[model samples]
Target: MNILMMTNTYLPFVGGVERSVQIFTGEYRRLGHQVLIVAPSSSQQIPSDETGVLRVPAIQHFNGTDFSVPLPIPGILNAALKQFKPDIVHSHHPFIIGDSALRISAQLKIPIVFTFHTFYERYTHYVPGDSKALKKFVIALATGYANLCDFVFAPSLSVAVELRRRGVLSHMEIIPTGIETELFLNGDRRVARKWLGINEDVFVIGCVSRLAPEKNIDFLVLSVKKFLEKRRKVCFLLIGSGPCEDKIKANLKNEIIEGKVIMPGTVTSQPLIDCYHAMDLFVFASKTETQGLVITEAMASGVPVVALRASGVAEVIDDKKNGCIVENESCEDFVSAMNWVQGWGRKNNLKRNAINTASKYTKEICAQKALTVYEGLRRKNHILRNHSESTWETAKRLIKAEMDIIKNMTRATGMAITNK
Candidate 1:
């Protein structure tokens, strides 16, 4: 099968959606399918070694975010589509490139699938003007357009429910993004700690996320501060970089100076795997994640999670089973939950459960499920088209037979009248 993925962002830019597309496409290729990517060109130069990745010419960066605004040249897109002839087109966003994807699907008469990857309402900070009204409009616009797609998939049930509540009339499915569990499970924690200069005796609580306002990094800092008030042997590692990196660091300056916190920008591959292994617990304070991919990664590494019981986090976390889910974002509640998990660590029950939960969401399982959906949609499309054509052919045959019979009857009646 030939699959075309149209996304707003891709590699060299690290984010949940970008990573998800990469993982899914990789799996599809391993299964003997062809995949093509269409994304905006990055500010940083793309690697020359990369293949099957096409970049649309970017006019400028979209606002100040890492995303770019592409000119969407129809000629280039048409040429690519004509050359590749994708079996189906899957779009990772609902705007920008999404419109181009829809147009291409229509011109080719192929099914288009859209994944509702983010809650646009929560990301109103990126846009200027009346945010509230803009959020409402964005939600309506996204859902309205998604309903027009062949199918819609949400990474979590929370997102699916929200889409439905917001009046998304599309056929929606819940498919969480998968992780490479064994990579995290097998990473060397000792090496990770030694490289980061973290002491072995200290309890490490970490989170991997973009340092942005939407992520609510301040909440994590405040909660960690509350935890450190009584516990002196605890350290925090905040990973990744984003627009609000300087602001978050400034807010946590005292903790940084005291050597109680480390912000190591972004680390990938083996280093990333090792970081997850070095953690005693994973803490997430963000209320905006569609699936909280980091939460699954940490759990896969045998580190339990303590997060706010909001959005998709609730779907993945079972209180005291795999991780602790605080009902609110209050610092006191987060601190209490952390303390409880710290005590619960002695039994190792949470760690076991965390691993178990993560096992259910491996990359292979997720890719297989997604492939099933894609194949099913494609099969249904083929069946419907064939059925329509078969019906039309049968109707034509019947009409022709009826016309011949009428002509024969007319000729016979005229001969009988002449003979009489």
Candidate 2:
């Protein structure tokens, strides 16, 4: 089957959504299916021999401390859709590129599917107060498009619930963002620690995400500070870069925890897995995530996660089992959870459980489930359209037969009256 994946950003523009699309599309291709990706063009575009990538021209804008938006390339996208002629159009974001895909899907009468990756309502604070109204409006627009789709895929149950709350009672499927299991298994903790110059005795608490306001990096910083107040031998490793890198640095400076904090900006998959391997614990305080792919990545690397009970994160993390979940957004709770993980002293058990949990969310498994949903949607659409067409044909035949009988009756009646 030919599948077209439309996303706002693609390779080289790193994020959870991009990673999810990459993994899913890769798996789709591995299954001997043709896959095409449509995304905003970057400076460096990777070539795909089997899978194709069509980059559309777009304008980029930075919103808050670390968030950016890519406006849609309308004309280029329309032309690409005409040439690609995909069997299915799967969209990641429900705006901009997602909208373009929806429109093209309609024009071509192709089945469209959407994966609700981000909750725009949660990030409304990024926009100005007066513009806040646009948040609900944007959600409404997304819902409109979602209703038109063959199926709407949510990375977590929480996302699916939110879509329902927003009146998107249409077809919704819950699938978690998956991770590459073998990559984490290949990581070497000793080598990773030596590369980062992290001491052997210090307990490493790490966060892998874009350093941005919506991520609540401040909470992680404050919680680490609180943890250091008692445990001075702990190190905090923050991976990934964003607009808030300097601000986070300044904040760490203000707290005078520079020595304890390590910011290695944006490493790729292997190094990131190694960083996770080197860490004793993974601390993620971001409340805005739909699925928190990094949490699963850390878990796959055998690092226990200390995260808030927010959004779809709960679906991946079983509190006190694989990882500890802080019920509230309080820094004190985060610090307490960190201390709990430290005192648990069952590092091996926690790590084992985490690996087991993450194993369940492998890319191949997720892709299979997603493909099942896509196949079901295709079948359903075919059945529905066929039934509608059959009904229309039956109605037309009935009308034509009735008209013929009426004309014969009128002719007979006219002849009888003329003979009389």
Q: What tens digits encode model 1's per-residue C-alpha lDDT throughout 146-193? A: 876889988998888888887788787888788888887898889999
What is the TM-score (0 to 1) of candidate 2? 0.86
RMSD of 1: 13.3
Q: Each candidate: RMSD to true structure?
A: 13.3, 12.1
Give the distance in Å from residue 96's predicted Cα in candidate 1 to where it truly belongs.
1.2
> Candidate 2, residue 185: CA error in Å?
1.9
lDDT of 2 by residue, 1-420 (tens): 788898887777788888988899888888998888887766554555524888667554444333335565647665666676677889887666776676666545568888888877666666676244455555655666576567888888888988898778678888877778988877988888999999888898888988777898888878787786666778888899987889888877745465888898999867877888898889898888999999888888888899988997888888888889899988888888888898874368898999999999899889999988878766765665543346566666445534543443454344434522
- Candidate 1, residue 149: CA error in Å? 0.4
Clash-forming residue pairs, model 1 = none
Give me the runs in candidate 2 sitting further than 4 Å from their true place: 43-51, 62-83, 125-130, 254-256, 382-420
- Candidate 1: segments with Cα more than 4 A from true spot: 255-257, 386-420
TM-score of 1: 0.89
